[model samples]
Target chain A: MRYGAEILVYLKEGVLDTQGKAVAASLTRLGYDDPSVRVGKYIRVEIEASDIDSAKETFDKMCKDLLVNAIVEDYTVKVEELR
Target chain B: MRYGAEILVYLKEGVLDTQGKAVAASLTRLGYDDPSVRVGKYIRVEIEASDIDSAKETFDKMCKDLLVNAIVEDYTVKVEELR
Candidate 1:
């Protein structure tokens, strides 16, 4: 079976997001009203797996091993069977 | 009123994603099987607006003006009223 996983990787709360801060400042300067911004990564992966559970397991492993920075980041994964 | 917008910015089809290709190669080298990967940006913005419709309009303007590269990238915005 084939599965598609959408992973959202974000900075942990209380972590300073310089990029987000810069974006917010830019928006405010450009005259957008009172905007707060946070930026993150959205990763889509297609994987071969036997079942949904295993596919999810693979995604978890991938996040822990390579996709996410555990010290300052957290990630959420959503999986669906691909046609 | 406040609205929160979730914007996903991704490379258009046929655009080359070098970072994604690098990540995929590294994952394969680390022994994940038969994985295809694409990477994008997830931006969460909180804005003060009169209503959801205007909030959405703000987001579209943001994307067009700054957040997205219209030539090689595409973006989708999801907006919700913030309590």
Candidate 2:
């Protein structure tokens, strides 16, 4: 079976996201009011695995190893069967 | 009313994502296999607006003004009423 995973990776609280800050400044300059703004990475991947559990395990490891930087980023994963 | 929008911003097809490539290389080095991978931005915003249409309009403007780089990126917006 194939599974799809949506992994959302965001800067950890207290982490300085310069890109986010720049965007926030731009928003304020443009006169759009917002409480705050933060930006992060979103990745979608399809996995060919025997079961949902294995697909999740593969994605979790991918996040740890290559996707999310644990020290500066936090990530959430949503997995669903594609077939 | 308050509405929530999930905005997904990704590089357009044929655009080079250097970050994604680096990660893909690292994954290959680590022995995890996937068909391919790409990385992009995800933003969630709470909008105080009259209705879903207004919320979508606001978010679309935000994306055009500050969020997605339309020249090199494509974005999708999903708005839902929040309470």
Candidate 3:
């Protein structure tokens, strides 16, 4: 079967996001006071897996091994059966 | 009141994603056969808005004005009430 996975990869808390900071500052300058925006990557993938469980396992492995830099980032994975 | 918005910013179809292609190639090399991956930005924000209707409008404006490059990118905004 085929499955779809959405992986959200984000910087860990306390890691300064320079890009996010710049965005926040830009918004504030435009009078959108105190906007807190953290930018990250959203990866969408379609994979062939035996079942939901195996899909989840594959997603976890993918994130850990290649998708995310665990030392500086954290990721959340959501899997669904694809038609 | 405060509202939370999750903004998914992605390259529009037909736009080539060099980074995504590199990742896909890396996965194939690792034996994760024919993995299809598309990468984009995920932005999370907490904003002060009067109501849901207004909140959605604000999110839309943010995306149009600063968050997304409309020519090559498309974005979806999801808003929720925040405690």
The residue-by-residue lDDT of candidate 2 on A16-82, one tens digit each, is 8787777777877887776356788898777689899998999999898778889999999999998
Q: Runs in model 3 with CA error above 4 Å?
A: none
- Specify the poorest-scoring 10-residue window by lDDT in model 1 chain A: A27-36
* DockQ of each model vs. true complex: 0.90, 0.53, 0.80
For model 2, the superposed segments whose C-alpha errors exceed 4 Å read A13-17, B81-83
The CA lDDT of each predicted structure is 0.93, 0.83, 0.90
Every model's TM-score: 0.98, 0.82, 0.93
lDDT of each residue in A1-83, candidate 1, tens digit only: 99999999999999999999999999889988868999999999999999999999999999999999999999999999999
- lDDT for B71 in candidate 1 is 99
lDDT of 2 by residue, B1-83 (tens): 88888789999999998877777777778997753677888876665887889778888999998788999999999888987
Error of 3 at A54 (Å): 1.3
True contact recovery of candidate 1: 0.92
Ordering by DockQ: 1, 3, 2
CAPRI grade of model 2: medium
Error of 2 at A26 (Å): 0.4
lDDT tens digits, residue span B1-83, model 3: 99999999999999999988999999888878688899999998889998999989988888988999999999999999999
Can you rank all candidates by TM-score, best first? 1, 3, 2
DockQ of 1: 0.90
